[model samples]
Every structure is written in structure tokens, then in C-alpha cells.
Target chain A: RAHSNPFSDHQLEYPEKPADMDWSKLYPYYYDENTKEMTKKVTITDIGCGFGGLLIDLSPEFPNDLILGMEIRVQVTNYVEDRIIALRTNNVETKGYQNINVLRGNAMKFLPNFFEKGQLSKMFFCFPDPHFKQRKHKARIITNTLLSEYAYVLKEGGIIYTITDVEDLHIWMAKHLEEHPLFERLDETWESNDKCVQIMRHATEEGKKVERKKGDKFVACFKRLPTPEII
Target chain B: MSLIHPIQDIVSSEDGSLIFGIIKNEVVVFRVEEGKSQLVGKWVDELDRNEVIREKVEKEQARQIAENITKKRKTNDESAKTIESENKTAKIPTPGLGAPTVYSHLRNVTLSHGEKLLIICADSDKSVIIFDIDNDNKENVLQLKKRQPYPKRPNAIAISDDDKLIVIADKFGDVYTMSVDSDVKKIDGNVEPVLGHVSMLTSIVVVKDSENKKYIITADRDEHIKVTHYPQTYIVKHWLFGHNEFISSLSVPQWNKTNDLLLSAGGDRYLYLWNWGKNELLSKFNYEKLIDKYITDAHLASERFQNEENNLREYCVSKIVSLPSNRLVAFFVEATPLLIILKYSPEDNTLKLFQTMEFAFNIITMNVNNNQLLITLDNHESQNKDFIKILDFNENTDRFSTNESLSNNLDTTIASTLIEDKTSHIGSTGIYPLYTTINLKKHGESYS
Candidate 1:
């Protein structure tokens, strides 16, 4: 359950394009049947969201914005989905947990297929698969090429939040994001005051496990820079 | 049904007179003017013909062998490098163990804007070799201009409108742009990657918009068509995501004068049309029913790729060529003898099937030579002289038809033409596998 190969030929379902994606089923509270459109689109994403901890915590904070979690593991995604459903069911009168939902997907490969260009305001990488082996470094969630895609889906000034307990993977992720032309690493000051970063610090199940183990947590946040104009 | 010393791939001049054919590791030049097609001259891969290159290859191979850290492991083909970036440059053993007999088969060729230089990709070395096409000379026609090597072999290439920049998308998912006008003397080392996909880049096209703003549109094996701002490739404009399978071909029809409409097809059920600049899927034309019969056993994934449930019969749109005059585009699926032609309707922003032209033999490759469609057929079986046919547009019939008498003259000229057969080292199979686009599919490997 801890290991899911990103490159595996898993038959994950995805819409052909962002326009074709019907988010109403996932967040029925936001759907407007008359206009046949959702009142709000998913702006905050928790990629590789193992459980629903981050999604649940962020849902109350960004109530105006729709929050979605994408997990590759079938059992983990189902657990999160059921968790969200139970929360929404309990608070049926107020419809409290309707903003957060989890979908099973290989986010590394299908990010653009689900989100449009500059569609996301914030993307959370909450203790993603470190893929520690030197040879499997490319399989890491934050890579140069994959960062380009992340930059594509993220709006200008949008932040990418990455937290990992693995020292080597944290450096690897930070180095790739720093080296990329479209992303500029945020300082400690920016990380401290950012509400989403604070939520992610204590939110993910992995972060909680690391806390229980007394392991060091490394957090790196990068802001998407505006694409430079063609000369 | 493998090609045994045929014109593996080809390109022609703007005037349609000069033809540069890839015969194994050789580039053969033929002038088709008047009623006769005369073989001019040819340039073989220098590693075999020239002493200088052979020595260099030997030295390079020795250095690579010495640089190797681990004990030698056998490699099947070029995909080994793509699988892992580690230097897999094995030592050159005779046609024996640990040593690789260089094939250097010429492929993915195109001419300059003025049709002056023959730009081609060599499969063996992952190098882009340029040749000067001499219009005046009769004997020495294809003069080697430059041979620039890269970390990974280029899968697709595109030239800028002014023919100044050569954009190369290597199989490792990296795209790099090199100045074509500059001297390419520094052909040995790594060229900085400009932009890339996380997946294998299958095809690329450099097109200009209404305001003459250039964009590099690239298709990858992961069913993605990315349009990025040229030169400033850091600016990814948009991704046209429609196909569920590997997108192998991208075409901006010359007939689409507005230059916004894009034609894309690959390992999908339909050919996709996109108003790329606006990030809109204009329409998609279904080809599954049409190509159902042509999908043969060869289209099936090999035993390595087969799942326990079934052997997937997969095929990709290998090549797409748009006619210059009419809003007509012709494309052929991998290893299929049929060419499906379509007409793009600007009014509806949709593509309609116009014709499905079938041949006696499967098509090896195709190129649009100034409104004339030149197709190289897989005629290796009978050693048929009608290996290459130039189909011309018939205005009255509103279709492209092959002229028999003209083709006869070409067949006659081709029979007399000769290029040194350099494929003896490759053993029984004459050339490397002609169709590899199908292999791009990842059929769920058990890594656990």
C-alpha cells in the first residue's frame, strides 16, 4: 500500500480534456443543474494525498474554493472517499464536507488532463513517494519535466507546497524546483506565515506518522513565476 | 515482409526534381525530370566508407568501453538508453559479443526551406547529420555538412519558418533547438535541452500564428500535444489533451492558411483536430471503423507486451502529410497498406473523410513533394520496381491518382540505380525494424 509505481499501466479513468470533466458528481453541492455548470471549480489540489487528512483540514480553511485529493492507491483513495462521504452525511444539514473529495489517479501523468492551464491556485505535495533509489529518482513526484507540468496547471503566484520526512528526497525536490526556470523557492518567512503550508505541516497521515517516529520534517514551498515573454 | 534494401525513407526538393532516398545507411540522390528518373549520386554513412570516421568510431568505442564501470550486459536495441540514462555505450565487438556493429540507418529526413540541405537523423549514433544537396554536380551530390550527436536519438525534428532553427525532440523526451545557419562544427557533445515532456516525444512541428508568433507543438507517447512559445520554451502555452493513447503525429496543414488549426493522430481511435492557439479541440474524426480491416497481426503487441487477459492489437498513426493546395490531409497508420485521406472544413472546423486509398503493398513511408504525394511502398517481397509512386492531384476527379506511365519511367530508372548494400553486417534482417511507434505503449510491466 505504501508503494505505487507511477509508470505502471494502471487503468485509471480520466476525462479527455478539462472541459469534458464533470466535477458535479464529485462535489454535488456546487452543481447548478439549470446552467449545467459547477458554481466553483477545484482550485486547491492535494496530489498523492495518501489519506484525507490534508483535504479535510484544508476544506474548512478554503471553504470558498473547492479542494480535491488525488491518490494512486485504490484502497487509500476509497478510504478517503468513504471518510469524506461520512463527514458530509453527518453534517447533512450544514453540508460541511461537500468542498473536499478524493479521486483515484496517477497525478504525475494526468495532471493536465484533469486541470486546465493555470486552473489551480495551490498544489500540495504532502509527503509524496520519495522513490529513494538513485535509479528511481525520476519516479519522484517533483522532477524537472513534471515541475514544468505543475507550473502549467498552477496559476501565476500560485504556490507548490512539498513536505517530506526523507532528507534526500527533500533536497532532491528542492533542488529540482530551484533549478527550474518557472519556479522560485520561497523563504522560511513565506513558509511560516502561509496558512496552507501550516495546515500541510500537521495534516497528512505521513506527517503524523513522522511526528510519532520523531523524524525530521523538511518543507519546501515554491511560487510559480510568470512565464517570461518570447524575445 | 521486411524491407530488403529498398528506399527506406525519402525527401525531395521544392521543385520536385531532386529526390534524396535513404537506402540502409546511404543517402541516394535521384533527379526526376522530364520522362526519365536518373540516379545522381549517393553518400554512405562515413563510419563504413571513410577511414577518418571509422578511426574516430573505434577510438570512441574504446573510450566508452574503458569508461564503463560494470561488467558488460547484453543490450537488445536503442531503447536501452531511453530506459536508463546511464552510459550504455558498449564496446564494439566484431559482429560479436560486447561489441555492436553500427547500423546508422538514416531516418526522419527533411530539407531546408530552400531545399538546399538534406537534414537527417541517424538511428545508430543519435546524431543529426546534415548534407549539402548540390544541384549542379552530377557525381558528388550529397556532401556531408554536419553530424551533431546528442545524448538520445532524435525521434522527430522540425525547422523554423525561415529555416534558421532546427528543433529536435529526442526519444528521451527532451527538445533542443540548434541554429541551422550557424556552423555545426561542435557536433560531439551534449546540446542543452530546451523543453520536454515526461514521456517519449514522438513528433514535433514549428508553426507560426496570425501575428507571426512561432510556437513549437510537440506530441509525446503519453497522448499529449504541447504547444510552447518558441525560443522562450519555458512558456508552455497549452496542452491539447484528447487522445487516450500515444500521440505519434502532428500536422499543421499548409491549406490551413490561418495556421491555427492542427491535425493530430496516433494510437487512438480517431484523428483529432485542434484550434491549438485557443486551446480548443475543434473536432475529432473517427478512423477505427475504417482501419479495422487493415489492423493485422503485426499490429498486435509482442509477447513481452501482452497481458494475461489479451494481446492488445495496437497501432499508431505513423505519419501525416497535408496537401499544399486543397484542404486535404493524408495519413497512414503503422504497417498498414491503406492511406486515409481527409478534407478539413474551415467553416465547421472539422475533418471529413474524403478517400481511403488502398495499395497492393503496405506503405513504408510518405512525403508531400510540392502537392504531389510520394509514397514508398513495402515492396521487399517481389522486389517490385513500383516501390515508389508519386500520386498527383486530379482537379476533375477532386482526388489524387497515380499516373501509370510516369511511374513506369521511375521504376525503370530505379532498377538501374545502385547504392552499395551496406547491410551485410546486420545478418538476415536487412534493416532495423521499420515500425517502432507501436512499441511506445507500456503494457503494464510487473515491477513488483
Candidate 2:
């Protein structure tokens, strides 16, 4: 019997609309500092948030902004969810990261489906897959087509921070990002000094693993361009 | 002085002033004007140097600075300059450490309405990548515009008439259509499947009828040519049959403005003309005689293959195109050294052999505009020199005339090696990229 092809067979499940999603379930304290009520927004997103290392490190830094971690795999998502729960439970007095949460999501397929137009300010693609072979190059997350979708959900001047231990994947991400009309390469000063970049480089599970293994990590950051005027 | 890199694919600007070629890991643009060719774009994918080494070097620098402070050495300009140089070296990202290559097999580039040159390339990574080539700048730049990852490898792609949608046919027999512009959201926020075939789809073309109805014409390895309604793919209009072997190429000839016709060619030694909407097989031109002349000359006799029951003389049509001059151009791989052009009539649904270009190398790729046809031949004898022959289609004579002096030839050793390596390593590694695989392993780890 032939093995059934499983890569893209199943219909990816998603919320009918971004607004229909229950934001309270994910972030209990998603309230504006002045209002002290539900703010109902996710300003930051980490795609392929493996082990939630970056999310955990970033949660306290931006306590007011709601950050969402989207991981496709159930276990990885669960691990992140559990890690967040533990942190919140242990540090209840600190108001403990009620603005951050993890959800199981396939960013490549459902990025635009889950986010509204210009909903996000910062997007992170950390340690993306290095599809080494030429044919599998499309499977790499940073592509021209996907960047358009990313551009749609990101606000004007939104920042896309991409980090990878694999040099090939880093170049791939940078090349695609640079080519997109909606995005421009962030200058070196902006990239080197950004707090999120430092946290992303040192905090992610892959980043930490690469550090331990003595593997090289390459980082590239781009800012989503404001809409271009029609010629 | 011309690009030394092998040309993987080539496309001309609609105005025909510039020539774009996919060379190795980058796309090179050449301006052809005033009888001079100037290199305008050389967009190369540069791998970012590993940061671990830079961090280690910085750590060493810090240790040295601490030691200097402890030793109380005299502050000197030379030492300061040395430290500054080291910092600069650390800042400069090195290149060529990794493979620094893109496995681009089949590529199609088009100039969009916004003056952007869009190149849709079939990457070795089982995904489709769109590179936006901007020529407005003094130095042309090729940037990655969009990318769609797939489970199965994409074999062929077709852009819609409006250039808003791209339909991709994959090896797993599924076709998907995605919007070219991200601002234009899907009707329901989902990429709809346009069509599917039981076998590997080799080629696809989006055609429109007189009623302005869009249809997707797809050909597969199983000798099936299917015409399905665009967007509403549940309705398969027709399946044009009668091929003895695998269908390799499909083309929608638009010489006649009134009627919609599809030109299909396969492993068999015949080309089929079909009015897919009406489910009519208009004509089938048997090219056995034309092919036999070359076959007999090359000593590849039909009688030698009579005993072979499984592999009957396979004359695959690798590339087929419909010229605006009421002519059909096809390249038969097994036939060798011959390019056949057939006169097509929409009124009577008749096709006749108009002309044949003999002694030409086996045509690997054929691109035709109104007045010119660019043909890339498979130079098996010499792997390095892959020449793209420019043939001018004379309107008065109705014949394609080759210009030997004007043709562009480049050493495609890199492209040939990539092709050979691709075939050898097929299915050896995990088809998915590292991101998906790691996530898959994470799934397994979480489950158990």
C-alpha cells in the first residue's frame, strides 16, 4: 500500500476572524495601563517560537505590550504554554507576564488569517529552517511570497527581526526581506542597539543551544516600509 | 567580461531592452541598447558570517583590554588603531562560508504593472520563490518578494492574466493559486486549491475564453490534459485525451483573437490541438516522418526498439509555444537536432507543418515574443558552453531565421553541475526544510 502524503493534506484549522479569538484566555492581564481593562490586541509575535526562550526573556521587558508566540508543533507550544504558566504562578506578585502567551499556529500558512491588517508592530523569525537542498529552498520560512503576507499584518514601520544559526537561512531571510517593497533593511546601528535583538540573540532555545554548541548565529533585521504612493 | 556564471533561465523585459538571466545563486540583468550590452544588476545571495566567531573575537578583545589595564601599559595610538581595526573586521560580515547557492531549476520571470520585474523560480527546496527585480536604480537589484512553501515539489507555475494570482502545479498532483499582492486578501482568508492531477503535473497555463471565463489547462506525466475552471476548480470542464505516453508540455496559442485553443505535446510523436471548452480535438499532427529523418541519420532505427515492449520510442516534447504569427513551435527531445513550427488555423481547427529548423541542438527551452524566439539548447557534448540562440521570426517569410553572430553564449558549468547533483540526490534527504523537520520532531517529543 502506498503511504498517504501528509505534508499538506490536512486542512489547517484557524479562527474564522482574528477578532473572534478569545484574547482573555491567552493573556489574562491584556489591559491598558491607564484603562486597567482588556486592551484586546497582540502587538508582538514570534513565529516558530520553539521552547519560548525569547518570549520568556521578552515578557518582562515589555510588560505592557501583549506578545504572542506562535508555534506549529503541539508539544513545543505546550512546553511554552507550561513555561509561561509556571512563570506566572511563581511570580504572581510581579503581575507575572499576563501580557504574554503561546499558541499553536502554523505561521507560514495562517499568518494573515490570524492577524488583522497592520495588527503587529514587531515580528520575529528565529532560527528558521535551513532547507539545504535547492529544491527544498522554498520550504524555508523567509521567502518573497510569505513576506508579502508578513507585510500585510505588520504596521507601517513595523520591524521584522530574523535570527538563525544557519548562515544559509540567514542570507535567505535577509535577501527576501530586502527584496520586498514593503520592507527595508534596518541600519546596523538600529540592529546592534535594539533591545529585542539582544534578547533574541541570547534568549531563544535555539540561540542558547547554538551558543552551547559553539555554532555561529547570524542576525538580520528589516523595517516594514510605509505604503508606497502610486506612481 | 560577460557574466561567467551559468544561465539557469532567461527572460527579456517586455520592451526587449534588457536581458535577465538566473546565474548560480543570483540573478544578473544585462542592458542591450545601442548595440552594447552593459551589466546592470548582479544580485547575489551572500551568507551572513557566523556570529559565534565574532563573539569569541570580541571576548578575546575584552580580555586583552583587561590585561592592558592591569599591566598599566602606556596609551598608544597604534594599540588603539589595532583595536579599532579588529572591531571593524568583526563588524564586516564575511561571505562564501556556506554553500551560498540557490537550487533554481525551472524559472519564469515577468514584468509586473508596477515596473517591477517578478521572477517566479522553482527552488530545489520544494518551494516557490518570487524575486522582485528593480531596474529603476542605476544598479539593478533583485530582492526576494514572496515565497510559498509546499509539501510536494512544484513542477510548473502559471500567472493569471491580471498578474494578481499565481497557480502552481506540484509533483504531488495538486495545484494552488495564491495572490501575488499581499494587500489583496483572499476572499475568505484561505488559498484555494485550483486543480489536481493523479500523476505528476509537468506543465500548466492559464487561458481565457471569449466569454472572459478563466480556465486552467494542466498537463501531467500520465498523458492527461485537464481543463478546469479557475477559482472554482470543483468543475473540471474537459480532459483532452489520445496521447500514447506522458504529456510533457502545454501551450495556449493566441494567434486568433476569437477562439481559445490549447496546443499539447507529449511522449508520443504527435502534437494535439484542442478546443477544451467545446471538448473538441481539433487536430493532431503526426511528426513521425520529420523525426524519422533525424532518427535514421543518427542510426536510432525504429526496428531496433520493436522488441522492447515497455519503452516504445519515446519522443518527448520538452517545450512548446504558440507564436503570435499563427504558428506553433515545439521542441522534441528524443527527435534531436530539429525544431518544428506548425501553421495553425482557428476557423477550421487545422494544423500543418510550416517549417522546420534542422541541425539545431536539442532545444532545452524555447521563449517566443512577437518577432523573436530565444532557444536554449542542451549542449551535452560541451557542458560549459550553453548558448541561447536568438532567432528572428520574419513576418513576411513566416520563417524563423537564426542569427549566429548575435546569439549570446555563456559557460553554464555551475547550472549543469546543479542539475546533475539534483538528479543524483533525489529523495535522499528529508524533503521538508530544517524548520519543519525540527517542528515535526518536537511534535513527536511532546507526544511521547
Candidate 3:
């Protein structure tokens, strides 16, 4: 009964195992550290982790940390799985590190559900869609309302890293972060101290795409300030 | 040696000499010798330092003296009243043949028709004051105009080739285009008002196509690359969709006669080259990629990443300029200002990068003239004086390299020679120094 596939009983069922899915090959890093317990050093959620390029690159940097790549599409998730299997790395945690996993959900809505109050230590929005129109302001990933949610999910001293090639969006993100009382701007020195800015600029896949094209990339870092002690 | 201090302003003289405005209200002149810069003059005081201090002190002292005399005369007899009035009149400094001690706080400067230098100063109560530097008559040389009700403070101004029109775009999306031909200045025309973009309009370029059609290309905070045809029709032909951020700077490449190319630099860290005629995207280059390559080299790549990681850079390409041989150069502001040269291949319709200029400081603006790439470095970031450097691109190698054998470098020699040769041929008034820098430390506080 436990081994019985859940989808087999349904009329229109997904394949018993997704076609061509070699589970052993998909998660090589999982078994490599079988003796080691996953440490929750820093819980990071990468929104729109396209192809898991960032998640894969970051795994080695923070072996003890738990990292999650939130992606919308199944195809991309499978591709990321194949990439993780091909690498066969360890210490690098991923749910997909046991610590790191990919969730299939829309980031704009699912962020609150996955993250408890002050649950995330770091969040990265690398080159999020820039809805140019004023009417589409609500759709922007970094908005006043979204910042409040991000403020809620991010722990006191938690950081949000954003990078974009668009000058307008850079200003937009900077404005929102600067305006929000719960967050504070990080100076150049603070930005340099954090490895996330460095990684987002060069190591990330979006960063690579912009670099190949000789594009301008604007970066901003904000820290979620501790909410005033409830008097 | 290292740009002498941050350059405050750089002006080109009639004889092709380069004069820089420095921090202490001093002008430094550099004589172009061979290929390098020969320091002809350093700290040439534009304003009499001693006199400036003395006048300020004297004015305050005289006010005190006048008040004292007035009080004493009132207490004593009325005989000292005549002497008091005389003393008050005497304290006022008389205008003479000597240069004015007051330093000009140049807010904005532009080239006017008849090859005259027109400088607009912020000192005249934020009024649009124009100065004719070349004119001998001091009377009415500087005319103050009433400040227009602009949506946002203007960042810069651009004059048409004919100098018949002046356009100013504020930090907000409001753009005012006026015909300065009349004495009574009014907003005869303007670009269509755009909202939702609260950031300042960074740059404005007036492009005259091959067919003599005039188009105004403006970059705004909303990341909109808007093009409006002249004469109030305000028809936006097409919107450039590449940049995801605010457009910082825009330039219409004049390197080729046939191609109408628009180069744009955005906060997004990409340089975009768009063909205005066809409304087609030409090329895009990133700055971070260049920096990554420089950092993660053959020696460092292995040590930097335990597992062999890709040694590729992602860049925010800040500025772009088209060269004479159908080539374009881009400048990036990241760890340092990285310059990359790319050739536009007609056969493939692609831009292939060929060379790079590794230098310190963020490159704010760049222009190509007489086979020299003139760049303005962001001195404010480095807490140094601003500088305008003319770099010569090696045609053979497509790189910017100094010739070891020459005293000066190739760019200086070429620029000086070109100016000398062209001045004799055209008999035109000296080429107006093309670059200006604002002291952010000094003026930044006021703006904030």
C-alpha cells in the first residue's frame, strides 16, 4: 500500500515517475552527505530561480545553509534536477539539498505560504519582470505591499538582494526599500560584505545573460529592521 | 599624473589646448605634446584669492563701521553725518579693468549658434541665465530669464545643431522645448507629458535623420525610451523594450552618415544600440561579465572556486559611442569603468567585441570626435577631481594602447593635430571645450 503509486488509481494520471526521470541521477548530492545532518544555517529562497543556475552555484558556497529555489514551471524544475544530478556535489545542501528544494508555485502568491513569520534569512529577486505601466505597478515584484510581506517573512537583520539591468527598476526597488520603515538601505561597504551581491552580479544565470549582452546592471541591498518592541 | 585631482570642468581652447576647472577655483591648462599631456599651467587662479577674501571681509567690516559711525553721530553732533555717508560710499568696491574676483558658479553650459559659448548659472536665483563667453560686450552678456514652472528640476540641456532650439528635461518626466530665437522666451513646444516615472530625465538627444527629419529622443526614470518628431506633432514612433531600468544617458551616434543609430545607457547595467530608422535593436553589452573575466583569470579561477567555475563576467554597460569605422565602444561602471569596443558587421547584422579599456572611476559620459574617444569620468564617487580623457583607438588592433616610443600618447597627439589641422581648414572659432563636471560634494548638499 505504501509502495502503490498515488497517480495510478486516477483516470488521467501523471506518469508513475515523470518520463526519463532518473531519481538516483537527479539528486547525487543527497546521498554523498548521507552521514551528515542538514544544518539550518541560512534559509534562502530564490524567487524565479530559472533553471536553478543560482541554486546550484550557491549550494557549494553555503554547505550548512538550507536553500530553496521557487520556480513556476515543471520543465524548468526537471531541468534543474538533471543539472543537480550531473554535478554530483556534496556539503552543498539542496531539499533537492535536503536543505534545498524547488517548489512549483507562483512566487507572487506562494511566498507567504512557504515562509513563516520571520522565517527567511535571505531572499533574492534577480531581474524580476519590470511591468513598465503605472497600472501594472501592483504586478511588480517589489511594491509597497510586497515589501510589507517581504518584511514579514524576513527575520530581523534578514536581507533582500535585488539586481536588474533596468535603470527604472533599480530606482523603483531602491525607492520602495528606502521608503519602507521596516527596511534600511545598505551602503557600499555593507553591500560588499554580503556575498549575495557579488554572486547575483556574476555567478547568477541572469547576471550571465546580461553580461554577455554588455548591459548595465543596477544592484540594491536592504535589511529588514527589527519591528519596534511591542510596548 | 592620476588626473591631478577630480576635474571640476574641462574646456577646449581656441588653439586646441585643454583647460580643466579644478577644485580650488583654479584652471589647469594641458598642452598636447606628441601623444601625452604636457602640464603647461597648474593652479592658474581664475579668481584673485586674496582679493576675494579681502572683499568679503571688507564688506562686513564696513557694515560694522557704518553702524558705529551712525550711532556715534546720533549721540554726538550731526557734523559726522557727511563723513559717514562718504565712508559708506567709499567702502563699496569699484569696478575696474582688473578681472572680477568673484568665481562663476557654472550650473549648465551649452553651445549657441555663431559658435559662441553660452553658460547658464544656478547662482542667479535658479533663473535661466545665459552668458556669451566669446562676446566682448559685457553689457547684457548674461541675461536672466524667469524660471518656468517645471515638474522636476532639470538635469541637463541640449541645443539643436542650428542652435535655434533649446530643450531642457527635468528629473521628473516634464520636457520643455523652446525656440530661443525670440527674446521673450516661452515654452513654444514640449514633449508629451509622461507620468508614473518619478525619476529624473537623465538625457536628451536631438537626432536629425538623413532625410533632414528632426527627432527628439528622451530617456526617463520610467525606463521609457521615447522618440518624438519635432514641431509639436509629438508622435512617438516606437518604444525601445530592452532596458528593464531607468535610462541614464542617451546619445545619437554620428559616426556614420547613412545609419541613424541611437545609443543608450541605463541603470540596468546594459548599453543598448538602436537603429532609429528601422526601429531595430542592434546590440547589447553587459559590464559585470567584463569584470568577472578580469577577476577570475587563468591564475585565480582555480583558487576562487574549488570546482572549476565559469570565468565569465556580467556587466552593466553604462555608455555607448559609435566610431568612424562602423565600430561602437561601450563603457561600464562597476568595480571600475570598463570600456569594450565592438565592430558592427554588416554581413551578419551583429556586433562583435574586439577590445577593452581597463581604467578606474565610473565613466559618466563618452563621445568620439576626430578619431578620439573623449570620456568624462565620475570623480565624485572616487572623491577626486573629474577628468576628460581623449583615447585613440588603434585601428589595426581596435584597442586603446599608449605607444611606448612617444612622449605623449596617440590620443593626445591625434586630437591636438586634428584640432590644429581642422581649425586652419575651416577657420572656425575654436572648438568649444565639450565637457563639464559638477562638484557633487559642493552642490550635492544644496540639491538634497
Instruction: Give the best candidate by DockQ.
Output: 1
Best lDDT among the predictions, by candidate number: 1
- The CAPRI quality class of candidate 3 comes to incorrect
- Residue-level lDDT of model 2, residues B1-448, one tens digit each, is 1123234456666555666665444556666664445666655533222443476467666766666654544554456545534543434345565654333344554445344646455454455666676667685556677656565677778877777777888875668877776543322213324456545678888877888777888877555676766655544455565664667778877675754777787667688888778867788888888777565333222453334553333345656777756556555544366788888765677888788886545555566655667666544444445546667767688677875555632223233333433322223321112111011111112222
**Candidate 1 collision pairs:** B92-B99, B93-B99
Candidates 1 and 2 compared: the better one by TM-score is: 1
Q: So what's the TM-score on candidate 2? A: 0.49
Q: Model 3, range B84-189, lDDT digits (tens) per residue? A: 5664333445557765443333344443544454434232122343433423333322233323423234565778888666777664444566555446433212
lDDT of each: 0.80, 0.65, 0.54
lDDT of 3 by residue, A69-137 (tens): 766555666677666655545433433344455655455533543454677889989887777665445
Return the DockQ of model 1. 0.37
List candidate 1 stretches off by more than 4 Å: A32-37, A82-96, A130-137, A165-172, A179-181, A209-215, A227-231, B1-4, B46-104, B136-138, B181-192, B288-316, B353-356, B395-398, B419-427, B441-448
Name the DockQ score for candidate 2: 0.02
Q: Which ten residues in a row have the lowest lDDT in candidate 2 chain B?
A: B434-443
